[model samples]
Target: MSPPSQFSSLPKDLEWLILARVPKRLYPILACVSKNLLSLVRSPEIHKTRSSLGKDSVYICFMHKNDDGVGHTSHWFTLRRTKNNPSTEENQLVSVDDLTFPDHAEPMPSIIACGPEIFFISGSYVPSSTVWIFDSRTDEFRRGPSMNVEHSFKCVGLVGSKIYVVGGYRNDKIHQAESFDLKTQTWELTPSPDEERLAFSTANVSLDRKVCGFMYLAAITICYDPRDGSCEVFDLPKDRWWETGVCVMDNVLYVYYARLGLMWYDTELGLWRVVNGLDDMKKVRSVAMGEYYGKMAFLWEDSACVGCAMKEVWCRMIGLVRSEEGGIVGNAEPAQLMGSVPSGYRLQHCLSVSE
Candidate 1:
């Protein structure tokens, strides 16, 4: 397609706004249209504005074994309202065509989302600490530098342009922590957590504002401040940390337990509280948990036996809210069914991309 001069005729500020609001998938094509548009598309200010304006959709990504259960594959999908049922609030998750990860990408690799880009960090099982990055803007995948040390099932957190990965290998605990510099496209070893003796594989990490946070060994929550290069350890009321997942939203750290309930920590107050309306979820398995809009969202897996040798697995979305008294009030909206994974295949990891 030929470049259009009409966009240039518009005012510069208006053009910037229009360009930033467009879908990320169109950036590559738009960049090919004109040099000015390309410059604006690659600018840091435009991306910053786009994120602030909420102009991006949230995509939920998962890795599961293929139908035969012989090999693994990963898929990226997003929830969108069905066109025919415009009045209904229900939404459906639609997969992106050809968005699957490389066959070499193994199951349970840690996934992190930075703006429009999703980074897949796989290691140990693979040849090395392989990194695969998917940029929604181009809808393409590119390889990144291998980590200095091999690790897998590690907890990841993003602080500024660097993504910190910790505790993938038990034997390498003393030096398992590493940071990936997005600007330089390289990995550098960082200081291990305060308590490296604890099993790092079981812990979960997230970034709250500028501080890098981690929930480790069930009772300890570590906060690493990059600005001052300081680390603080906080004791949790609960003796054991759940494997459900951990995420940061609105500057708060949320940790979910598969059996008990969802617990959240207030960074400013330094206190933890259990979300109130989750009695029904105590028995169900939590596949993944993350933030949707401003509410707490989780992917739940339900199992049932229908007189068959194997059980049936179901997946659904649940949104929780916090009341004034620090209780989980109720669902922010009706739970939506997102369909189930194939038999013998289970959800390994879940992350949301705002692009």
Candidate 2:
């Protein structure tokens, strides 16, 4: 076999390797030189083969300010992991408006969530908040039933198949959080018992993953003991909010997280100590869930912002000490998976968000 002859000239596989190693800027030149190269780069098969998982990645939405009073679909963009490392505008964003259902009607991106095979985004420039289901694979967004309430919607999210909505206001005294179940096609509105405590802005950011404590308390892992108002917990396995722990500032459980094993808030003693080891963080925005080198942990975005504001987001990686289920980290997911600006592509000395 004599070492396969001259490596570079001997085979087509070697040619692809040579081309792959070449600077990407040279790709345009490569394509220009031959029609075959152009077809290869444009091949849909190439993209399909690269990833067969369907598009399960989380997509973030922003209210893109535009010339029109109601923004156009073209302004709505989605970011995903890319091999090219996201530099150019094309790499940074993929317009999902076109992928929406084949209706010429306007697309108001709202109520974004990552379901198993779809990202549900619904909103309306009109008084009614319309729900839209987007199929990432088909890139089509289909309009669903319109919300009955008239005021306008502030926030929306989902736990499993149930969609929860908390609002801005219809009139006065309409303080409520509405729950809609897609599986049953049933819509139920509950006068938000907690409306007095959380205002409109709070409701708008209500679904924001940060402010909620993710320990064993409220909704995700273990049942939260609502007996103590101090904290909010989600038992993930059961997929419901529980009343286990309470809130805490310092050692006082200003917020309770039962799963993290937080039991008490020493406001009377006025001291703060982890009655349970879950006393890591009091708040967070978005989180990433995965095993880091077989150890579960979290990466997060401290604040929530729309558009490609990863440049504005504060990205942090927290090493979580895993329990039986998964690791926890606050402000974690969006920043690492989709938000942060790519190295060398984004300038380091960007100005502060407020500035």
lDDT of each: 0.60, 0.35
Q: Quote each prediction's TM-score.
A: 0.66, 0.41
Clashes of each: 2, 56
Model 1, span 1-355: residue lDDT tens: 2246777777767776787677554675678878888877766566445545655545665556676967666666765445575333445566776566663647556667876788877753443478888787678988877888777545567876788876555454444477888779888877665544232444345546333434445567666554443457776656455454666664566776655566777666777777666666545554566654334556665555544333333333445555786554545344567665444445455555665
Question: Model 1, 179: alpha-carbon shift in Å?
Answer: 3.0
Q: Tens-digit lDDT track for model 2 on 220-332? A: 32111112212233323332222212221111122222233323333334333333243444444233222211111332334334444444323222232323533222222
State how far residue 177 of model 1 sits from its true place (Å). Answer: 4.4
The C-alpha local distance difference test score for the whole of candidate 1 amounts to 0.60
